[model samples]
Target: MLYVLVKTKKGTLVGNYSSDKAGCILGRSSSSLVPMAGRKVADEHAHLEERTDGLYVIDGGHRAGTLVNNVRVKEYGPINKDDVIAISDYRLQFRFVRIGNNEEDSFSKRASILPVKSVEEPSPVNNEKMTRWREKIRRSLVSYMDLRRVNVADMDDDALRIFTAEAIDRIIQDHEDIDSEIDKDELARQVLAEAVGLGPLEPLLADDDISEVMVNARDEIFYEKAGRLNKSEVTFTDDAAVISAIERIVSPLGRRIDESSPMVDARLKDGSRVNAVIPPLALKGPNITIRKFMKERLTADHLIKFGSLNKSMVSFLELAVAQRKNILISGGTGSGKTTLLNVLSNFIPDNERIVTVEDAAELKLYQPNLVALEARPPNQEGKGAVHIRDLVKNCLRMRPDRIVVGECRGGEALDMLQAMNTGHEGSLTTVHANTPRDCISRLEVLVLMSGMDLPVQAIREQISSAIDLIVQQSRFSCGTRKVTSITEVNGLEGGIIQLSEIYRYSQRGYDKEGRVRGDFGATGNIPDFVEELRSRHIEVDMNLFGGAQESEAIQDGF
Candidate 1:
């Protein structure tokens, strides 16, 4: 069965119908099934119908018009449950309810989790008693938090930790009958987690070794350290607690999370990236993911120490930047593209003016003449939304010596490429791709996203002329991130972009402890960019390309 429900000035109207009829009419005329009495509604305003495929609402050439989800309906389109339908002044949410013999099964099919059978035998539970104690402590902490008004922003890390410890001690000492066997130290940590830090996520964030934290649900948490994921014993009390932590993170930044807007992308005060999604889009409840940033800026030497890349690669990259060659770092997710971008960005002359545009503002460039711009989401009215493309267009007026985008994910790639081709010679950015050739293909796709309808050959010409180098970064199964390849783009040939591999990473299989063993070696192709470096009076070491040249390079401070 199908129905049309609308809220009018008189009252609510719910009418049921079947697909057997041509369609149902909505208007102010007497012939309409659900006649709305309003001047804005035409005599034949709109038509509602249901097909085997889906339910749809079509506009009937009315003056006032029909709208769905704030966008005017051009003709007719498929509608789903909970979709907002507007007719003149009133707004109605669409709902579909199935009737007949299979209704019970339909309801069960829509359920997120299956119900536990009453006759099923229970398995042995691990740490059930300890979980109960933790829940009690969490409840107590929530209660204490309600009566407290501490200025957390004014305290340093040590002061905050001390205050948290004292508060937990007072709460436990005042309620001795709560649980005598509960460990006081453990209780202190839990209280600190709820009161000061993100619950069940504080320890992971504190540990420098941990790189990522993922919250699947209130009671299920996971962390990654050294490229390996491990489930933690810590858990939240409920979904509300998980939401509270997310609110604590994004609210301070003037971002909101609720039914109206349930998804958000934000960054921590320390520049760690955060992405969150809540119901009803996320069936599991609220999900929070945090990508922790380093406390200290990582440099070329740090990469060498971690075996991510050798000295020769860094030296070549430094020269590439110095020679004003546009560079694009390509890699899969979590492959250290941004990290390598940061390392290479340091080579930019301090006196040159630099402009960086990003969604979350994660880049920490230290140039004195640097300008950073971040995109902004719209307000409740769906107005004032500033996108990355808008910022890229505006940066052109700022007289930037070099433009660096945190990452290109959309049509902004077109503007970034245009900016690179139009005298912004030393621009830098990262794109998501697996290899160097894939990077070029991804660029072509992103250029098409601009909706310019240009010829493929024109876009290829723009890409090949603007980008001089593509640095491929990859993360191995052993959690190692390395610069796998660096290819030089040498103009277009036979309607295809020509690429010369200057450096390549060869994997020597995994080591005994499951670490990836790889060595960075030159492909023996002297890059054309070397001549550009020499023209700029930069010294060149031909022997640096030799794999065994690390012996003397260490003495030369490579």
Candidate 2:
């Protein structure tokens, strides 16, 4: 049997393999036997294959190639016992013991050779001492706060971090005689993290693969990566640590969460959406959910790469936007609704002025003339609340070339429809629903919520005339998000809005690895907007709407 022992910042990692097998690849790929999902590791970085004589290591042509015993290897080489390999920032020690040899004896012999801790779990006494050290660091921080006469509200982040580091150093000096097993750098990091960052969430948030971070309580944390939820080993020290982290998030934005008002929605500086619920309303201690925002603005090419939409779909959507069709993107929560809306909005002409309204202000439009408006929650006295409806109504008077409401969750849907009906032709918005037909019904319900006291038929007529297209975005159980349907609004018939599906996603069942297996195909229905597009001299290739091969050959001819 052969195995590799790697030392990470988190802990010691032990990956074992049988020498009789072919080989075990090592990289950040999910299929790799030992997946190193760190920022420094490449996608399919390196491989280890077993041969006739002995095991061999082959460099996977990584830009940052693998290292053996402090020297970079140019090609394949034989693996020897007690050899150290370095990949990215990680250092791994190799061990090869015959299958019949005593495993326990080999582990003890090898463990002593490395500076890192053994792969075995930490003792309870060590855990207890670490907890005590964390408390001493917190107490020292409090003492420093009092001695320096520092106000948390007034101090800048750099100043606060300096004080925190000094306090942690002092605590380390005071406890030097107690134990030397504690990683002082890590302890200081934890103290600073608890003070300024989101505590245990800092590392999870830094991981690019993790899309969602959920903190059920102080000690229980889970994160969603690649559309699957997994329990995270990271956790807060106590309930107080969780509460302190929540306060750090909402305090800067003037949002409050407590027994009086225990729920708030805030966003990080990088535009990641955050929702926190504490005590009273929340049965769990302190529940926090964070949806990470992508730093790069995704365009049509990116969506096509993700299989969210094909080139034909992109061409049709681009033409629809250029033809000034009002688009309503409908989907359930976390279904990539806003992302699709942003991509479609990019199809609009750069010369036009765009006004965007949102509760959290997440849209990143590249147009120069963009008027971004955000809603405000009322204060403790229940005053000064600016809602989506108010912003929608006011944006009309701003002479916007197009009005884009982030998501119509309330009465704002009425004002958005009216604006689209009057002069705003290329307006865009999103709604919560499962299908395109359900989106019209949802809009009717939202219009009724406007307190207009209008007839149901009147609202139906308004919706049918205003919305030209409904792009239904859906997030599958496997965590892949795609545009499930693109339906054209053919106006109201028999007092009900009529819809025709132009493109639909056909699911072929889940793949072996559990990823979504589907195809985006046209419904063979020629859209009514084709004539309008031709009238405006917008050259939309007809071959794009054809079958698979036809569409693929000239999908770039838009």
Candidate 3:
């Protein structure tokens, strides 16, 4: 017997085919399957079956062509794994393999012999009624609860009693009937506290402008909006409630956190990053942090509009990308390093194959020829985990034109540098560092983490040769993230890597609104790539490099 597995979006089904049916079988007419003759079979309810290990025919005679996501299968060939078989408009995936001798008997007994049925359809009228009922209940509950009276800051005994009574009334309104014998007031208070979100917390989470949510235990909850961190009037009744909330947030994602695992890093359906740590790991009680990505990705044009870069900086970076310069973006945490990397990646031509490796899949590149790879955490048994170092080494064999490392925090930096030095030009990566000099030292330390005993000078030499540019970003006190410096490495001299400041941000005090005002301009030193740009017939604007006073005004905004 041949073990055959069928998969749909809902779930997977396993079965076996006998030798008599030519290893082919018919599913519901709604399924995605095609006949060997490359024609639609006319009989909608024909019960054609498959034989063991032999090709069988599919009778797909329907209005919709038998195609897998639109590709028409024209032959009765062996089905490969992940091959979508389309019988009509409905689709199914097929995987066929040999059944082991020891498991053949059990597999035959477990094979599903019944014909597949069409998917059940729900009644639209019933669904509409349910939605209306839910809306009505929500409105009634909201009205019965006194949101204005419940103050999270100072809830004395008298205030608690009044709040609890109001909560009970709201709960009674939500339900058709309630048991009088139960402690309805206590239960109501608990439910109301959760639903009303009695403070600024719920509004903060609902606000699309907020990018991050942070809770420092049960007493304080902070949120970041428009890159500025603001304290919310949210508080948990106790540490237990905070832990419970964390559990609920991670539970839907098939993640877990308890005494056995007091910490978890997870993501929500909306691509928001979440991190939670309970007691022992977190001394101040359970804490949760959420970083939300924008609904629309940040584009290069958006960066320019935000005064992150001037025309010269943009043009120079674009040319550097086209010329296959390996660039490194250095910055402290939350300095928009990944954001800058994403914008720079847009300069890459769409025709070249690009591979992106990251701890989390955060970078959103627009190129068509892109392969995104994310690192996986270890399973419960601590097995089957794939690290960034593993992915960095694997990418070298993937025949990529450019390899982008989202951010290098570990030994993966060594592998990434090796890939850059070998043949992967135009590769881009980000590192956590306070300054350009510190970035080199960080690289040396990370390379040592790879278990290679190479001299520090050797690592520095590799970095100077492999990296063409280092772009440093900074987050100001006003929460404005900007590119502070763009330095070009010009090889090493006397055991020190030589770097020239191509573009520097000169702090010119602050504006009337107290926002940072700085001028981003060249330091009068032309880049080594100037000759290369001239060779390509690209004109140089010396005035943009601060040769003229009018040019300073033009570059001040960026």
Candidate 4:
């Protein structure tokens, strides 16, 4: 990887950046990758470009000019890493570092921190020039505090931010030139955000409409809003800066990521999911994908309003959950499985003790009697790893009235099936699958992953008897997620599990506005346990699922 170390006139290392990206624009403007505040630097001074011949420094046609090794040049080398490229008062050195190779570590790399730790810190951020000044001012504040023997560890967040802001003002006034183009107020704000808050992500997280934030590179970003993806105007200073942010996130949770471990799964204070990739694994430079959590907990009514499901499905799920029926939710990534699970979980009576197992705890259950368990990855020493299967096994010992495994991705499926069959009737979990039939096959594969050499027929029988319902969630071309199918596991027939769909979503086509035009219809196949529900004195409107019925209250025209 190509690296750049930015130094001051006094030779203080300020910013460390590295990327194999084609080029970098350096100037006084915020758009420049290495922005300088000095008056001698033009707004668009110079840039570094990697060519077929080699890396070269090209002048940006400014009279201030680009210099390399103390000589004025309109253009410079296929530059060596040892070369020093200078513009204005700052010194820049390029270097290349090699990283270790290990493509097979992807699965273990995504391990999540046990018992997720989240700290609620808030601040604003932006790309490039602001990124540089944020670093400089942040360094200045730390130095000022250190030189004066200030112990900031004991100070509260508000106190520290206030103190840091004052020190930043003093540093700029005493150090930076008066004619420099840097905006002091903006500098102070960015520094404060980086030092005390999430920097750049604060605004994105605060926007309720945005569901996700993607960091592709230092100066490029994207976000999902209104079920559509769009480019974001925000960015970071460089790859190193992005790495720093990733460290800040994983470190607080007692998790570590380095050359040995290059990826991680974490959660924000609001329970938003976080995944970061760096170096050899990420060719585009450091990458971060954040799935933002909702501020308000969603209920069945919300799903109905959003055209995800209708009253009949909600009513059936409520009865099933209350009756202690094991349910397995299936969906592709980000298809609202968790959200639907969260809503369905609420159906359990408050009197029952519920235990939830997850990789990173995202469910927000309001029941007074509830225990949530998050999975743990091995530490730096490669020991004490707690997988989802272990959590499921432990939950069985807790005497939980209801067990909810967040997702059955591995051997946990076997343990979950056993728990469901062995009197943990109301257990719930999810898996990645496209259809109800695929869900059965997925469960069989997950069961085999348990390391037991059980016969295929036995595994099929175990699944058929344990899981009562399979709710398939799907994300459409228009980005709307809906319940595509809700099928009941009737029984094992000729070594195959029989599935009868009680409800399904049929999309005729897309509308003029490109929104999916679909309707949730009843397939007229009632659950095999419906008679048992009636015998137990539970009431259900059987006619609701008698035939093709669309939810009349949908506002999205589904």
Top TM-score: which candidate number? Answer: 2
**Clash count for each candidate, listed in order shown:** 0, 0, 14, 1
Candidate ordering by TM-score (highest first): 2, 4, 1, 3
Q: Which residue pairs in candidate 4 have backbone atoms (N, alpha carbon, C) closer than 3 angstroms, thus clashing?
A: 125-200
lDDT of 4 by residue, 246-285 (tens): 8878877777778778889988877888999988898899
Q: Which ten residues in a row have the lowest lDDT in candidate 2?
A: 549-558
As for model 4, its CA RMSD to the true structure in angstroms is 19.1
lDDT of 3 by residue, 1-558 (tens): 333333222232211222322234454333323221113434442233445653333434455445644565434444443456555322344433344434334334333221111112224553334333433443555565445554544653223433444544545556764444333433343344344322223334546566678998776788776556777533555676577667656776666787767888776555667789998889999898877666557776666666666667777788789889999999998788888898899899999999999876778888999999988776677677789999999999999999999989889999999999999999999999988888888988999999989998899889999999999988776666778788898999999999988887777776665567776777777778776777789886655455221122221121
Q: Number of clashing pairs, model 4?
A: 1
Instruction: Put down candidate 2 lDDT per residue, 462-484, tens digits, no spaces.
Output: 99899999999998888888888
Runs of candidate 4 exceeding 4 Å displacement? 1-129, 172-184, 551-558
Model 3's lDDT to the true fold?
0.65
Better of 1 and 4 by TM-score: 4
**Model 2 per-residue lDDT at 31:** 71
Local lDDT at 84 for model 2:
71
Alpha-carbon local distance difference test for all models: 0.75, 0.76, 0.65, 0.77
- Superposed by TM-score, candidate 2 places the C-alpha of residue 165 at a distance from the truth, in angstroms, of 2.1
Models 1 onward score TM values of 0.72, 0.75, 0.63, 0.74
Off by over 4 Å in 1: 1-131, 137-167, 535-538, 546-558
Over all chains combined, what TM-score does candidate 2 have? Answer: 0.75
